[model samples]
Target: NSSDAFLLYRVNEAIRKSGAVVEFVREHIILENMVSIFGNTEKQAELINILFLPIVWGFFHIIKAFFSTPLSALSDKIGRKVTIIFGWTIYTSVYVSFALIVFLPSHIQIPVTFVLFTIYALFYAFTEGTEKALVADMVPEEKRGTAFGMYNLATGVSTLPASIIFGFLYTYFEQQFPGYGGTFAFGFGGSIALLSMILFSFLVKAKNR
Candidate 1:
């Protein structure tokens, strides 16, 4: 069909938008990296001061291994909806906490900041482990390959615009609200929550399924 091409294009656009929103959030975080915000020497000194980089690497791999088993097993039992809700809830809470940390007085101890960041990682684990499973639940096994391919295409295509938008927002917010990265995090998390709600409403399973 001549119109099949047009429909695919529209589908691609929708996929792009969804991915762009996520990428926009990511780019904001990356752009706000302390190294970029400060400078190389400053970033190096800060990392050394905290011994952060190596510790972070070790910590994440450990956490990933620890969480992967339970999350995967839980998804099999409780179903994807519950797991996704838990994941998003955890994700939102972490972002809220992160945002609060930004607004917290600058004099707060480094350890306190580290704790907040760790909470963020904990939620990320839930999201990462469960999201693919949730997608599988929604798509038929026969179409899983196509669905995943489309999802990947959407992610890749949308990332460009997402990065651009996030860069714009991050710069604007930094100038306007200096030292308030947490507020941005809160906003992003809220947007995700809204999207989640909308998805719940619209993306229902078939009656037979």
Candidate 2:
């Protein structure tokens, strides 16, 4: 649905599949291994890794698509910077919440994940079209193509390593730290989003003022 959401979901999906190399391992990764650190039953945790995950994950996108147009329009009414900051805040919250999933039991997962997914939808709704629109608002018309090109390039460049790091977390770091891999990786991502939001605030004041 959106770039920031796109990026984070990749990390989200990768965290499970990238947990190991073998096909069976990929299918069975994440939930079980994650909960095992706290001594939960593998079978109980495996419940979350099943069909339930996709259904809820897909629902998140539907809600996002439903609200995206209206929320993007909200940017026109308020301001792109404010809307974007709001979206970034939502993204940070989502990332932080996902990271904290380790503390929850398998039974709590359904409601907890559903709530996070719902909130995650709003993140995309706030940022989707607004990101490109913000670029247009900030740059001169004559250089719009170059600006968009640069925006896409930056997003792509960052995505490569972000994927790699996320992939590594569920694979190597999970092995080393047991339950903390996702926590560290997602917490790091949330911190980056928050820092970027703060920096963007200063940029808005500088450019808009």
Model 1 RMSD in Å is: 12.8
Which runs in model 2 stand beyond 4 Å of their true positions?
1-48, 170-172, 205-209
Where's the lowest-lDDT run of ten residues in candidate 2?
17-26
Predicted structure 1: lDDT: 0.51
**lDDT per residue (tens digit) for residues 76-119 in model 1:** 77766665567666655654554454334333423444464465
Q: Considering every candidate listed, which one attains the maximal lDDT?
A: 2
Question: Relative to the true structure, how large is the alpha-carbon lDDT of every model?
Answer: 0.51, 0.70
- TM-score per prediction, in order, is 0.62, 0.73
lDDT of 2 by residue, 1-209 (tens): 11344334433454344332123333566744644564344554354444455766688889998999999999888888889899999989988887777576544544666688789889889997988898888888999999999999988788878767666664576689976776777777788889989998886642341
Model 1 misplacement above 4 A: 1-50, 105-109, 206-209
Please report the candidate that would top TM-score against the real structure: 2
Error of 2 at 27 (Å): 23
